[model samples]
Target chain A: MVPIYYYLILSAILFSIGVGAFLIKRNIISVFMSIELMLNAVNLTFVAFAHHWHQVSGQIFVFFVMVVAAAEAAVGLAIIIAIFRTRATLDVDRIDLMKL
Target chain B: MHLVLFFIFGGLCVAGALNLLFQRHPINAALSLIVVMSSLAVLYLLLGAEFLAAAQVIVYSGAIMVLFTFVIMLLNAGREDRTHGSKAAYLVGIPGAAALFATLVYIFLSYRTPLGDAGLGNYLVTTTDLSKVLFRDLLLPFEVTSVLILVAVLGAVVLARKEH
Candidate 1:
């Protein structure tokens, strides 16, 4: 049996990488993927804690998270398509027409 | 045995995530993310969440990644042109991320409270237990998610279709 901390630590590291990429990456798609990465890392932590505490609620929560993620991905990708159609580019820096 | 399994899948997860972070092309990054999700599913399996393992693979790696790839292709996004982010990102992001990770690890490791010998066992999370909990305790959230998905679908259609 592995200590639950190992899973927790792994989740933390994955989350940090996601955050770093989220800030550093310039592409909107990459940034979106980074958000998914962050979500996944959190889900891993929930599952680990659920295992440690012997609770089913955490897994159920993960299910909900996945459902929301699917919906978010759909809307987000559609928005990205819309933005690209208008701006003709995917670089986050160039889509600044909305900037005040 | 558990240690080896943990190291293998965990290493795969971390490696795939890092690759996704650094990959230049969205498709490459998307593929790498698929690897990460698959590894995460394996970790869930090791942790005794069989249903979640299945869901992680089906919903995340399968459906979500496919959606991302479709968008990537539809957008015809080329390799990203490197742009200078805010100075704070270059100056503080890496350090902040490292600090956050280190802090989390430290907090988890310092919990000397006995976890009471909880071993990873299969029955800890089965499909029946998961569904029962979801229907019994989490029913409202499930129905709300359905509504959210409907809204998302409508929004996607309205947003992505050609504007007259």
Candidate 2:
């Protein structure tokens, strides 16, 4: 059996990459993808801990996280679409109107 | 065997995430996100989280990614002119991310605490157990999540609807 540390390390790398992409990417869609990446990274950690502790609670929490992520994605994309319709671009830099 | 499979799925997840990051086209990015999600689902299964693996697939790959794809198609947000930002952004972001990765790696590696050998052997929850805990203990959160999903759906519809 592989050690749990392996999974934890992998999850950390993925989460870091996701955070980097989310912060540095200029495209709205790319940012959205990065957010998904972060969620996946969290899921990986949840499963690894669940395995390590030999419990089901972490797995159940992961299910709820996925449910929330799905709903968030739907609403987020729709809002992005609405913004794009008005702005004609998905560039994060250009959508500075909301920035006060 | 487990290590090999772990590396395989881990590679898939990393590759998919990188593709989503570097890919310019929204459709390609969306597809890559789906790949990432599916591979993560496999990882969940390898960890014995069968329910989580199924939820990962059904919710993320089937529902979320599809919604993303539709939004991409509806908005036709395929072509985006690159936005201008300071070169310092990448320099700072990369190092910040690397630092965070190193910290997490250190924590994971240095934690020498022994995990109890308690096993869930033959303790898999049946439908009754699932319902009992879900309805009895998690009922409030469950109801909140349901309302949240409903609100999100309504918000999406309102946002997508054409202005009169």
For each candidate in turn, the TM-score is 0.95, 0.91
The lDDT values for all models are: 0.87, 0.79
* Per-model DockQ against the true two-chain complex: 0.73, 0.60
With a 3 Å backbone cut-off (N, CA, C), the pairs that clash in candidate 2 are: none
Best by DockQ: 1
Q: Please report, as a value between 0 and 1, the fraction of native contacts recovered by candidate 1.
A: 0.77
Among incorrect, acceptable, medium and high, the docking class of model 2 is medium
For model 2, what is the alpha-carbon lDDT of residue B78? 63
Clashing pairs in 1: none
Question: Which tens-of-lDDT digit does each residue in A5-71 have in candidate 2?
Answer: 8788888988998988887777787789789889889889987887777566776687688878878
lDDT of 2 by residue, B73-103 (tens): 8777765555456256678888898899999
